[model samples]
Target: MDKVQILRKISQIFFFIYFIFFTSFCLCFFGLIEKFILKGSFGSLVLKLVVIIVLTLLFGRVFCGWMCPFGFLMELSYKLRAKIYKLKKLPKVSEELHNKLIYFKYLVMILSLVLTYYLATYAFCKVCPIGFLTNLYGTVISLIILITFLIASFFLPMTFCRYFCPLGAFLSIFSIRPLFILKTNNNCVKCRLCEFKCPMQIKITENVNQKECIRCFECKSSCKKGGISFSIK
Candidate 1:
């Protein structure tokens, strides 16, 4: 394989390793999800927030695409769905509805924050489906909810990140001008292959630096002519 292909493979491996660590039933490094679900009180959350947000301000939602355990599960479920529906794909949502749906995450983020503050507790944690993957060892309901979400991921790929993740809502605020951006060059053929591959469903050719971009680089890897590359500007 070419050097670019090797690099892409390396990136995939890194993401898989990160997924294992992030979702491990016992290990704790950052433990953002566990802290949110297990303990109602924030523990070193301000520090974690500052670090991740600063990184997002520089790199966009790399955290969502590469590191977040729930995102990993959702993407896996989506891939399974694609295989199941190989003969007949699901209908794509209208662009109008898609645009509106993008904003739903922000609303949920707001509600979560308000409830967290008003209740003086981590309000959503009690019912967050992510609890099943966390160290908390959640209840039977959490298990069922987690299974439901995994099933739903087939229909709504990365649904929680797109519509309910508070961290995504926070990170997206600063993604409009990431320090490292994906750019397409003259080699591009406008084949739309990259667009089809994008999990964020971005029109990547037109809006590589858009606020919603997650910096997953799937489009970069999918591009056939080496048209897409990271640019420092």
Candidate 2:
């Protein structure tokens, strides 16, 4: 791995540990939103949400790339699967299918919000895979949900983040036009290495400012030709 990828791995590990120690305060953004709706007021958790929104607006979804504990697990699972299969690179969904599937996250986000508001409960949290990780006492159904998603990640890589994570969907709203974005330069050979490396499977060459981009810089680091860079957009 390149320096940027190494740094990102270190950041993911550190934040995963931090998350374990502060699970209550570091609940996923969707869970926090559920809490705010159920209580009908803002709290410290909401303050954290505000901070996340600001950061996402400026830097894209850095939290997913660098901080999310569950995302870290998904990455690990993907790596493990590759190792077990002795594959140079895992297969990716077709671009047409990927485009269709990505919108599922947005639907999940809207459904979560609507359910939380109408049901007067933390409906999403009750089954959230991240919540399941933090709260081991969750129901058997939650355990099934967690295992299912983890297995999906092993096969598809970040399946939850790309297609089902309400938090990712919510963050995408602010990250679509973040201050900084990944861009390709004149040196690009269209090798498509960056796309293969992208955990979120973003088509960086086609659109660097895509909302699904996690700002991981994998594309930048993977480009041996120095074709990709993160810059002010």
- Residue pairs in steric clash, candidate 2? none
Candidate topping lDDT: 2
Q: On residues 147-220, what C-alpha lDDT tens digit does candidate 2 reach at each position?
A: 89889999998999999988899999988888887789999999988887787877777876558888778778
TM-score of each: 0.78, 0.93
lDDT of each: 0.67, 0.82
Off by over 4 Å in 2: none
Model 2, residue 25: C-alpha shift (Å):
2.7
RMSD values, in order shown: 4.3, 1.7
Look at candidate 1 and tell me the lDDT of residue 199.
70
